[model samples]
Target: MRVTRSLTIKQMAMVSTVTLIIVSLFILLQLFHFVQQRRLDYAQQMESVALTIRQPLSEAVLKADIPLVERLLATLKLSGVIARADIVLPDNIHALHNEFILEKPVPALVSHLFELPVSIRIPLYSPERAMRGPLALLVLQADSARIYQFIRVTVATMLIAYLLLALMLTVAISWCINRLVIRPVRHLALALKTLAPEDLIAHQLPLLVGHRDDELGQLIMAYNHNQQTLGSIYNEMYCKASGFALPSLPNEALFLALIEQHSKSVENAAPLAVIVLRVETLQETHTLVTDDQRNILLITLVNRIRDCIDASCVLAQINHSDFALLITRDSHIFRTMRLARKMTRKLTQPVTLGQFQLHPETSMGISLHEKETPHAKELLNRASSAMMSAHYHGKNQINVFRTGNGDG
Candidate 1:
């Protein structure tokens, strides 16, 4: 069985949030336990101090020894556990060693919730009787300020720790997700959206997506494979239908597509020119040379044209003996004419093929784009017509198509 490995941003958030909550709850539980334990310990300490002074306190009260009783109360008050201390007589009389009194009555709810000061009343009995009736009352108020301060500090510390932990977790989780998951996914999505047939043939994918080994990588590989397969099939169909083998340069379909796309862009305001070059002596050269020799000659001719034109110019073998050059708006009429003449001179030069010197006659025709009629097919047709007219003039001739020119 395969276990699916999938993690999303939402899932990450939920997991992190749950983890933080659990940790916070655990800290709170520990804090509560600590507070309760401290409270019990403090209460025990207060009781122990009261017990230690019980005998003296009893003797002083029984003999009506005010000085002795006052000293005992003062000693009891000195203990950190006791916030206040006093002695009370049976006749409803009271003597406070420190004159300690409750400054303000605390609400029951507040006291219960926060565990405020607690008052303990211990009965004093006669020393001889051991269990006789109480001679005096010893009241001790537990010092709650220290415990309350501890509780407040502990709660604040825990809250701050929880927040810091949560922040750190969030940052770490988000960074991991973005690096390992979200970023890759987003990159893949954009790559898919912008994936082109040419890019697939070149085996190009987004940087991160191409390098990954996960599901996104698999998806991109699959897409690239499909695109390559489709491109092969399309090329096969194209060659069969056109009755010509595919050439190294862009096909007529791609050429026309580029022209149409460029025509739509308003930013291309310069004049555009389409130049067609027809090899008039191609058949003669083919009969005189082997297939290999013919290929070399064609390669040499294409290379010369490429050297003469700017890299941005689009060149394509449009037909068996014809080539098309697409000069963008960046070029002017003068530049286009110069390139056409240069191509004519290059192609008409004598080439040595297997001990035989052969010179191929070529005709060049150029047509400038007209704003009123801006179509690729129309421009190509006009250039073709001009090339045919050039063929009528002489070998290695050039012609330019103009509006209302019967020659075109």
Candidate 2:
């Protein structure tokens, strides 16, 4: 329920990691596709080179002209990639060529008369029947570095484009998350921190900005629900714990009010009872639990006592170990004594704390309203004196203060 800075850090980290993983997977898939495309293009380029030289060699074979074939092959060899070329004719006739007109037989597919742009093993098989007029065989060995350079350039371009796109997407996604999710949560956190423990009226909750069906919307709804629940609890606790002075059991503010009303009430003075209740051995309980746990136990005790009292009975926290109750009715003495006995009895039962159970004790003191009491200060001193006497006597006891007349 208490939103902390650590929660914000953890949420941001989770969202960022998810974004990174998604972007990485997309980039990897695109790179794989790009590599495959480049490889296929290279294969097609190599096939095109092999096909281009086919027509010229076939024409040379049709004419049965060796000199013309030799000149054509030599011209093609100027492409710096051709290694060998051959025109096989019907009846065992052959027109073979090379780059330098080598004296030895040419190797299997490395001809000296064909042109290619990159390193490739291309086997050119004549599409005609074996006994046909002409059959051309072309082989080429080109520079590999040139092909690799082209592929590198193309891949580099694609990668650059992909990187730009990825960066744009990352920015857009982070911005959206910051606006729709992170910003709202931050505002809610700020609102939570500034809230006073006494504030009762609920302020309007902020509305979610983006997709209603999404997780961020759900988070906003959950946060609002939790805030409302805590707000209600705080209001109830604040009102129950406000406006009384302990030991004397007077509202310091209301004492002025009583003074203003004293002239009218003096003609028929009503009895008043002030009860000062102390949780005994609270220091021992403090040693038994953490500060937070001690607060929980003490708050539990306060709520229990509050359930037994009415709204007119002003109650307030006096100290870490005590609470005060002031009743203004004519029957205040009887009601205060009865409620104190019931509350002290209830506290003697064991309370569960994790795996341990603790039994707490209470001591209470009662002081009656005196018509002759000079001020609020005197009333409080007498009540505190009675409470101290009860605590000094023993645990779980109630002592009442009396004037020298011993009437109260």
The TM-score leader among the candidates is: 1
Cα lDDT of model 2 overall?
0.61
lDDT digits (tens) for residues 95-203 of candidate 2: 4635432333333332321222324443333345554333544444444334345445755776677666766666676677677767777776687677875553555
What tens digits encode model 1's per-residue C-alpha lDDT throughout 1-408?
A: 232644465757775788688878978797878878877887788788999989988888888888887787777756667778777777658765454434445556546875777667788889898655788788777766666777778888987888788778777877776787677776666665776766655455643534567776776777777767877887777765543453477766777777777666734487678888888766667687778888888788777788888877888778778888888855677888788888878788888888988788898888878777568888888888888899899888888999885554
lDDT of each: 0.76, 0.61
- Highest-lDDT candidate: 1
Candidate 2 weakest ten by summed lDDT? 109-118
TM-score of each model, paired residue for residue: 0.44, 0.41
Q: What overall lDDT, based on C-alpha atoms, would model 1 receive against the true structure? A: 0.76
Q: Which stretches of candidate 2 lie over 4 Å from their true place?
A: 1-72, 78-137, 199-221, 227-408
